[model samples]
Target: MTQRTPLHPVHLELGARMVDFGGWDMPLAYGSQIEEHHAVRRDAGMFDVSHMCVVDLHGAAVRDLLSRLLANDVGRLKVPGKALYSCMLREDGGVIDDLIAYFIEEGWFRLVVNAGTAVKDLEWIGRHAAQAGVKVAPRRDLAMIAVQGPNARARVVSQMPAVYQERVLALAPFFGVAGGELFVARTGYTGEDGFEVMLPAVQAPTFWLALKAAGVAPCGLGARDTLRLEAGMNLYGNDMDEGVGPLESGLGWTVVLDGERDFIGREALVEQKRRGGLRRLVGLVLEDRGVLRAHQRVLAGEAGEGEITSGGWSPTMERSIALARVPAGTGDRVQVDLRGRLVSARVVKPPFVRHGQVLVNV
Candidate 1:
């Protein structure tokens, strides 16, 4: 049986087309995915991301423990409510999961992880805690809702309690604040201003209702995928896995090599860097009518081939684009094999659309 989130019924009542995502019953779209995506680009939209796991870690040594475990140093977080995005890697340097860690207080951090990988992430975090002498507490009791778009912040804030309303009003981007049992983070996957709220599961329906009343469209996973891809974000299983390293996964910046810390997979990354960086990941824009999809083959001059990891016809840009892992030297002019037909494409940096504007050149 597929797992159901606390707000699953709400999604159904809203006429959302539900599907199985990572073993959980989730919405694919409310009706038209493109319309939902556009809502987020032009106004505000919300997603019931309660399926995502919110784990809270606490212990005297938690700070030091995270600093040692995460590929991105947690020490970089200075502000109390600041959030840091990082990847937890295996000993061999394979990405276990990419998650956001929110620093609330000393020795306490809130980590939100992907639903499918939550159990695995928890196990890995627990194992790390055992060795590092920290405590890992999974917040299964909490549900997450992501409100994204140009007006996303404003729409979501209207639903917050007065105390939280004022606090969130002044909260800067990438920061989070806890209002009673509600934890609001000014962060989201879409390339738009928004918040990802974590609260008790029982309160999910209430919050969802409030957000709907505030005119935030009920967006689903379809829109979320296209939005994140356009924003240059990586999807864990599709973009990278335990078999692929950061250099090939567009996450080279997350790897901290300058430090003396002995994080997992450091040796291999060092070797790969010294040997010349591993094949790089790039964003591709299809000039042709064909849609670019995952696993599609991309061909450059002289038989050079790449593979698309994530692709879609962006509702904001109104064009097909994708993130592809290509040869270390793949060039701008490329062709993607879509259903046996070659489609002309241009390799470009992502954020195909940001703040209601298209970033890619036609």
Candidate 2:
């Protein structure tokens, strides 16, 4: 049976067009996808991200266990409620999953991982936790909602309890705070200022309704995809997988190689760096009139060939944009083989838009 989130009934009531996403029944769109995308850029919008998995780790050895499991160092998270983005890798240096780790206190941490890879991630962490004497507990009773855009923070804060309102406003980017039954983080997937709130599953429907009443538009997966693509964020299955490492996937910054504290994929990454000549992930803007889509071949005349990992029409930019993997020395101009036609495209850095501003020329 296909899984459904706690807000499945709510989505159905709103007449959402539901689709199967990685084994979960999710809303593709409630109405116009373009409108929803614009609402996030111009105003405020919320997404039911309850499909994400939340796991809490507790034990005296929790920190030690994480030190060996993740590519990014968790030790840097000195302040409470601080979060770190990191990748879990296989022994061969292939990316297993990318996750966010929140440090609550010493010997206690929280991790939010991709829904599709939750089971495998749990098993992987469990195998290592047993030897380290750490306890891994999955928080299935919680629900997540991502409220994004410029007005998102103010709207969410208005719905918070009176006692927590001030604290929520004081939260800095990449930080979270837990009070009562709510954990609000100043983090988001879209390139906008917002909060990702985690609350009890039973409270999700009521909270969704409250946000809706507060004039926050309800956005679906379709808008979410377009927003993330415009933001230059990587999707797990599309951008990177067990076949690719972080270095080639435009995530080299997440890996820490300075110290002697070696992680699972350290050796392989070091060797790959020593060998050099790795393909790189880049942003592409279609100069010709056409839509870009994944699996399309990228043709760099002299540098070499590559493929588009994620591509689509950027609603914010009003243009087609994509994230492609190309040869390291690939120049600015390239051609995309779209449906047997060679169309010219410009290769630019990722992030076509951020904070409602167009970062790249259209």
Candidate 3:
């Protein structure tokens, strides 16, 4: 049987087009995908992201285990509630998963991983955690709601319990606020300001309805994908997978190799760096009519070939953009083979859009 999130009934009532996303039934869209995407860019939108996995690590060795387990250093998070983005890799230096680690305290840290990779991530963490005497526990009792948009934070705050509202109001970007049974993180896949709130599963409905009453449109995954792509963020499997490393995926900075401390994929990353980054992921903007899509062959002069990782029409910019991996020599002008026809596109740096404005010169 397929799995269901805590908000499944709510989505059904809201007339969402439900689809199976890695076993869990999820909403692809509520109605018009473009309109839902626009709602987030122009106003506020809430997404049912309860399918995401929440794992908690407790005990003295948590920090030590994470530092060795992740490509990024956990010691850098000096303050409580600070979050760090990092990639966990295999012994061969290939990515296991890219995740966010939150430092709540020395003995308590929380990690939010992709739903599809939850089981694998837990297994990976477990395999390494024992070496450092850390306890990795998955928090299945919670549900997550991602409220995104310019007004997302303010709208969510209005409905939070009054006492917790004050603490949430003080949160800075990338920080989390934990009050009572609620945990609000100042983080979002969309470029806009928002929070990923993890609360008791039973409390999700009330909060979901309250946000709706506060004018936050209920968005589905369709809007989420477009927004994040425009924001230049990478989706795990599409942007990079177990076969790819950080250097080519635009996540080199997340790897903190400052110390002699060995990380899982450090040797492979060092070798890749020494080899001069042979291939890389870049953003492309379609100049003509057509949607860019994953695995689409890209041609740049000669016989240079690349593949699009993620692509779609940007509801905010009213154009199409994508992330493509190409040979190191690939340049500005590239052609995408769409439906066996060549479509010209301009290659540019990512973050195609932010704050409701287009970022690249399409």
Candidate 4:
């Protein structure tokens, strides 16, 4: 059976185009995907991200267990509500999932993981938690809403309770604050500044309505995908999956390989690093008059061949862009095989756009 979020009725009432995302029925777009995308980039827009899973951990062993489970070191998250992005890996170095870990307080931590991998992620954490005697509680009773854009923060702040408004505004980037039933985080997947608010599932509808009345456009998955792609953020399954490691997925920075942390996949990554000659993920700007799509073959001349992991038209740049896994020494230029015809492209760093500004040359 397909799952529906708390705000499903609201989405239906708004005439959003719905599709099955993973096992949940999610909105693909409210109307025009391009218009919704622009709303998020230029003004305030909100996304119903309640399908994402939130898990809270407790007990003295929580930190220790996380230290061994994730590729990134959680010891860095000392201050309360500080969050860190990390990847959980298999023993063989393959990425199991990417998640955000928040240090709520001593002996307590919160994690927000991708909806598609929640079940397996819980099972994986449970298996490890049992040994360490850590308590793992999934917060399925919560709903998440991501409000993003240049004006996103101000709009959300106005809707928040007066008592909590000041604290929410004082929250630094990558931090979260909990008050009553609300947990507002100064973090978002979109490159624009915003807040990701987690509240009781029952309150989601009213909150969604309030934000809509406040002039926040209701965006859906289609716009979300384009926005994150332009921001150079990686989608769990599309950019990196169980078959690939972080090093090759342009997520090497998220992995803490220094010292003797002894996390999962440490030895494998160490060995791979020593072996060298690893393929890398690179950003590509289409120079030819063709659209770039995933699974397209990329020709890097003598350097070798590669494949596009994620590709589409960048609305901000008004050009086609892609993230491709290419040979280590690939040059600045390459060719993408689009419909049997080789189309020229330029290799650049990720982040084709940010804060409504095009970062790359069109």
Q: What residue pairs clash in candidate 3, if any at all? A: none
Model 2: per-residue lDDT, tens digit, 1-362? 79999999999999999999878999999999999999999999999999989999999999988999999999889999999999999989999999999998899999999989999999999999999999999999999999999999999999988999999999999999999768999988899999999999999999999999999999999999999999998999899998999999999999998989879999999999999999999999999988999999999989999999999999887879999999979999999999999999999998889999999988
Task: Choose 3 or 4, whichever is better by lDDT.
Answer: 4
lDDT of 3: 0.89
Better of 1 and 3 by lDDT: 3
Candidate 3's residue-wise lDDT over 45-140, tens digit each?
A: 999888889999988888888878899988889999999999998877788898999999779999999888999999989877877778888988
Stretches of model 3 off by over 4 angstroms after superposition:
none
Off by over 4 Å in 2: none
Every model's Cα RMSD, please? Answer: 1.2, 0.7, 1.1, 0.8
Worst 10 residues of 3 by lDDT: 271-280
Relative to the true structure, candidate 1 reaches a TM of: 0.98
TM-score, candidate 4, is 0.99
Worst 10 residues of 1 by lDDT: 297-306
Q: What is the lDDT of candidate 1?
A: 0.88
List the global CA lDDT of all models. 0.88, 0.94, 0.89, 0.94
Q: Against the true structure, candidate 2 has what lDDT?
A: 0.94
